[model samples]
Target: MSDAGPKGRTGRRDEAAFAITPPQIVGPFYPIRERPDLATNLARPMGSAAEAQGQLIYVRGRVLTPSGKPVPHALIEIWQANAAGKYRHPSDMNPAPVDPNFKGFARLTADASGCYSFRTIKPGRYPTAEGEIRPPHIHLTVEGRFDRLVTQLYFAGEAENLADRWLNAAPHPDRLIVNLQEPPSHLEKHAMVADFDIILASG
Candidate 1:
C-alpha cells in the first residue's frame, strides 16, 4: 500500500472509500492502574453528580475495513489527560493537578452499523519530560476479531500538531486529525462533536 494517501486538490480523501488508520505507539501511559470504566460517557462517572472539567465534546464515528465494510462490535478504548493536561496515572509527573471528577478513560463497542459515540471533555496540551510539548490528543485502541490497531486522534487547528513528531510521522497524518463540529440535536447544545472513523486492515 502507498504510504501517501490518495487525495484530490482539496487534500481530502473520498468518503466512499477509506485508507487504513495508521498505527501509532501505545505511548508511556496506557492505563495500567486498573480495569477501565466501560461507560460511553466519560464526562461524568456513573454515580458522580459533577461532570468533568473542560470543553465538553461528543466523539462519534464508525469502525470499518480498508474496503469500507463496517466492522461491527469492534472494541474501542480511549484515554486522555484532563483539562489541566494532567493524567490520573501515577507515572505522569507533569506537575499539573489531576481533576478528581474527570474519568478521562472509556471503553466502547461498535454497534451493528459499526457506529460508536462517546461524550467527553477536550484534553489539554502537556509538556513532555524530554522538553517537547505534546498536543491535545486522545489515545485509542481498536480491536476487531482479527486485527488490533493502536492510534491517536488529534484535533484540527492545534498549533502543537505541526510540531508533534508522533502525529507528523504517521503514514496518513490527515486521517488522524478531525475538525470539531456542531453536536447532533440529541446532544446538549453547548457540546461540540468530532467524527473519527477507524479503518482497520482486517477484521
Candidate 2:
C-alpha cells in the first residue's frame, strides 16, 4: 500500500494532467418539472395548434468525461426564452409575448455516443434589470454519473455576447459559445444547427 502510484520525478501530483469543463451559474429560472415529450420539440408541443414563431434550429452536442470518453445516459436539461425574448416563467416580467407553442424547456438523455439533440426556436435578446440587453442563449444543466454541471450556451458571432454579464465573467468564454451552422442535408432547408459539447470533471 504505497501512497504514490504515478507521480512526476519530484514525487508531486500533477494537477495540470486534468482539465475539465468549468461550471457556470445556473441562473434563477430552472423549470420546476421536465415534460419529456413536449420539450423534445419546442416548435410543436403536444396537442398545440400554433407553431412556435422563430427560426427553427437544432441544438446538439456530446457529453464527455475529462478523459474524452463519452458519458452515456447523462441527463441534459435546457431552457431558453422564446423568439420574442420572453421566458415562460413568472419571474420574466417582460412585456414580450410568449410563444404558445414553445415550452421553453427540454430534458434529453445522451445516447451511447454521448450525443443529444433538441429542436427549438432560436431565443431572442432580453433586457436585464440593469437596463442591459442580454444576448440570446440557452441555460443548460448536465447530470452525469459522477458529477453535475450547470452552464449557458451562447450563439457564436453574436455581438451581444461580449456584453453578457455571465459570459464575460466566465474564465473561458469561448467554451460557452456554440457555432451556428447549416443543418445536415437530411434536415429541412430552414433548420439551422449548433453543437455544444460538455466535459465533466470526473471520470
Candidate 3:
C-alpha cells in the first residue's frame, strides 16, 4: 500500500486505511478468535470508573468525522475497574482491594483543531461469571458526536482473553484492538494496557 499523499488528495494513507493497529491477544477467557452475537449490552464487555488512577497511558487520539476531520472539544469520558478485579465506586460489591491511587478519570480539552489526549492506567479483568475473570479492557464515553457512544477496549496479548464466556457472545476476531507499547509498560502496582476509540459519522 502507498502512503497518503496529501490531506485532501485521494491518496494512500495507511494510517487512514488502518486504525489503532489491532493487538495480538485480547479478551481474558472468551473465544475472541471467533465472532459472537454481541448485539446487546449483556453480551458485551464492561469497564468501571476506577481504572484511571495515578498512572498514565499517554492516551492521545483524534475524534474524527467520517471524512476524517477532527471534532474539536469532544468530551471523552473513560471509566473502568482496577487491576485487582474491583470497582472504586461504592456501589460495586466485588470483594477485592480497589487501588486508591487511581481515580480512573482524565478530562481533556480538545485542542483548537479537535484533538485530545490523557494519561491513565490500563484496566484489568473482573468476574463475568461464577469464579470466572473476563479479559482486561476499558470503557469509553464520547459526547461530542451527534449521539453518545459507550464502548470497550481490550488488550491484544492477554492469556485469559477469549476464554470469558461473555466475550464469546461477540466473538468477532476484529473486536480486539487493545495493544501494548514499550515506551511506558504497565505499572508494577497495576498491570494492563487498554486503548479504545469512539468513531462517528461524517457530519
Candidate 4:
C-alpha cells in the first residue's frame, strides 16, 4: 500500500508532530524528601493555622504533544523559593526569611485531559552567584513515557527577566515566560492564575 492517502485524508502512517521542550539546569536544590500527598496542594500544611505567606497564585496547564494532543498521566515536579526569595533548604543563604508554612515543593499528575493545577505563592527574585539578580522563576521537571524535561517558568513583565542569565540564554525565551492573570469567577477572589502548557517531543 502507498504511504500517502487519497486526496487530503490523513493516512495511518502519518508522522506525529513533535517539539522537544528545551532542557534547563535542575539547579542545586531539589527536594530530597518526598511527601505522601504532594499532588494535592502546596499552600499549607495539613493542619497549619496560618496560610502560606505572600501573594497567592494558581499555576495550571496541560501536557501535550507537539501535535496538540494531551499526554495523560504525566508527572510534573515543581520547586521554588518562598516569597522572600529564600528556599527552605539550608544551602540557600540568601538572607531572606523563609515562610515556615511554605513547603516550596509539589508534585502533580496530569489528568486524562493532561490538565493539572497547584496553588503556590509567587516566588521572589534572588541574587545569583555572580551577584546578578535572577528573575523569579519556578523550576519544573516533567516526566513522560518518551522523554523527561527540566525547565524553569518565569513570570511575564519582570524587569529582572531582561538580565536573567538563564532566560536570556534560552533559544526561545518567550516560551518560558508565563503571564499571571486574574482568577476566574469560580476561584478565590484575590488569587492570580497562570497557564503554562508543556509540549513534548513524540516518542
The prediction achieving the highest TM-score against the true structure is: 1
Clashes of 1: 0
lDDT of 1: 0.89
Report, for every candidate in turn, its global Cα lDDT versus the true structure: 0.89, 0.82, 0.50, 0.82
| Residue pair clashes in candidate 2 | none
Tens-digit lDDT track of model 3 for 123-153: 6667753667767666555556464544556
lDDT tens digits, residue span 1-203, model 1: 54345565543454447789999898887888867888899889787779889999999999998767899999999999999998888789999888878868878899988999998999999999899999999999999989999999999999999999999999879999999998779889999999999999886
How many angstroms is residue 39 displaced in model 4 relative to the true structure, after the best TM-score fit?
2.7
Model 3 stretches with alpha carbons more than 4 Å out? 1-56, 129-131, 164-176, 184-197
A best-first ranking of the candidates according to their TM-score comes to 1, 4, 2, 3
lDDT of 4 by residue, 43-113 (tens): 77566678888889999988988767888888898899889888777677788887888878878788888
Clash pairs, candidate 4, are none
User: Backbone collision count in every prediction?
Assistant: 0, 0, 33, 0
Candidate scoring better on TM-score of 3 and 4: 4
Best by lDDT: 1
Q: lDDT tens string, model 2, 1-203?
A: 56554564554445433346667787766776555452568777777898799999998878887656789989888888999999888778789997878878877788888888888889999987678898999898898888889888889888999888789898888888888899899998999999887888873
- Note each model's CA RMSD in angstroms: 5.6, 4.5, 10.3, 3.2
Q: Is candidate 1 or candidate 4 better by lDDT?
A: 1
Candidates 2 and 3 compared by TM-score, better number:
2
